[model samples]
Target: MATEALAVRQAVPGDFAGWLPLWHGYNEFYGRAGDSAPPASLTEATWERFFDGMEPMEALVAELEGRLVGLAHIIFHRNTGLVGPTCYLQDLFAAPEIRGRGIGRALIEGVYARARAAGARRVYWHTHESNAVAQRLYDGVAERSGFIVYRQDL
Candidate 1:
């Protein structure tokens, strides 16, 4: 499909039904699947955050032919080292069949645009080491930060 044919916009309340599967797919891609799925309460809370005016979290969706094809979630937060806020491209996913059709790029670019508008000095995200395909795209659009990630569940 032509890139021009795809529309990227802020997700609306009406988009919940369409966005659910895509959200699940994104979690699944990150190894959250079947019994490991996030509880409904957490998922619903995340969904609600997008519409909460006081929340810094936001969600964008890409639609083609009236059907949702991609989703991107971003969060704006304070950074001690920077004068402006930092924007984190938290989660991004394009439908499997439309993976290489520029959907992801559009979503990332959209996030960049939104970040800039929100006074964010930098926009960054990470992918699993195994996701070479996405890394290839990331490598083209943004430089690798050279910082490794560490995490611990409290």
Candidate 2:
């Protein structure tokens, strides 16, 4: 499939129905399904943030033949080391059936364009070390930061 046929653009309210499945799949890929799935309130808030101008978050969707096949969510924030805001690609996912047709690449390029337009100096994201497939795509499009990730549940 020619990536040219894929339309990568800001997601609209109408896209929620199509976007939810991909969002769930992304979570499930990381073992966040069922008992560990994110709460509905959090999901609802995330969606609302994308449309709120006061928020620093945004969402992009990839549509092929009018069906959404992928999604990218980004956040822009001030960084102590950067003069300009940095763009963090919080989440990126393409449907399993359409993994290698350039949907992921196209959505990433879309994020880059958006980040550049937003006066961001850089764009970055993280993936589970075990996700070699996604890493393959990430490696081709962006450099590995070589930083280990750590977290503590509040």
Candidate 3:
């Protein structure tokens, strides 16, 4: 596959149909599918966020041969450690068959470009400890912060 030909761009309203499957696959990879899946309300809100100018969330899609092959959702927020906003790449996924072909890298790089344009100080994201394949790619592009994440449901 010639990854050089693929294009990454901000997602548009017409992309919802193609982006849905990729969204489900991403959630399933994280054990959030089927009975444990998020409610439709949450999904709707997420999609809405991408189109809402008032929201700091944005989504990028990878297109090749007129087909959507990947998706990345990014969020810009203020952080106490930085004077500028930080970009949080909340979700990233490339089609199973297209993994390792540079689609993921393109999407991440796309996010980085967008962050830079938005005056964000940094772009960061986390993956499951078991996702070594993804880690290999991530390691090449960004340094790991060595910070452990902790969370509790209220």
The C-alpha stretches of model 3 lying farther than 4 A from their native spots are none
TM-score of each: 0.97, 0.96, 0.97
lDDT string for model 1 (83-118, tens) is 999999999999998889999999999999999989
lDDT of 3 by residue, 1-154 (tens): 7987899999998999999999999999899999999888988899999999999999999998888999999999999999999999999999998887999999999999999999998999989899999999999999999999999999
RMSD of each: 0.8, 1.0, 0.9
lDDT of each: 0.94, 0.94, 0.94
Q: The CA-based lDDT of model 3 is what? A: 0.94
Of 2 and 3, the candidate ahead on TM-score is: 3
lDDT of 2 at 99: 89
The residue pairs that clash in candidate 2, if any, are: none
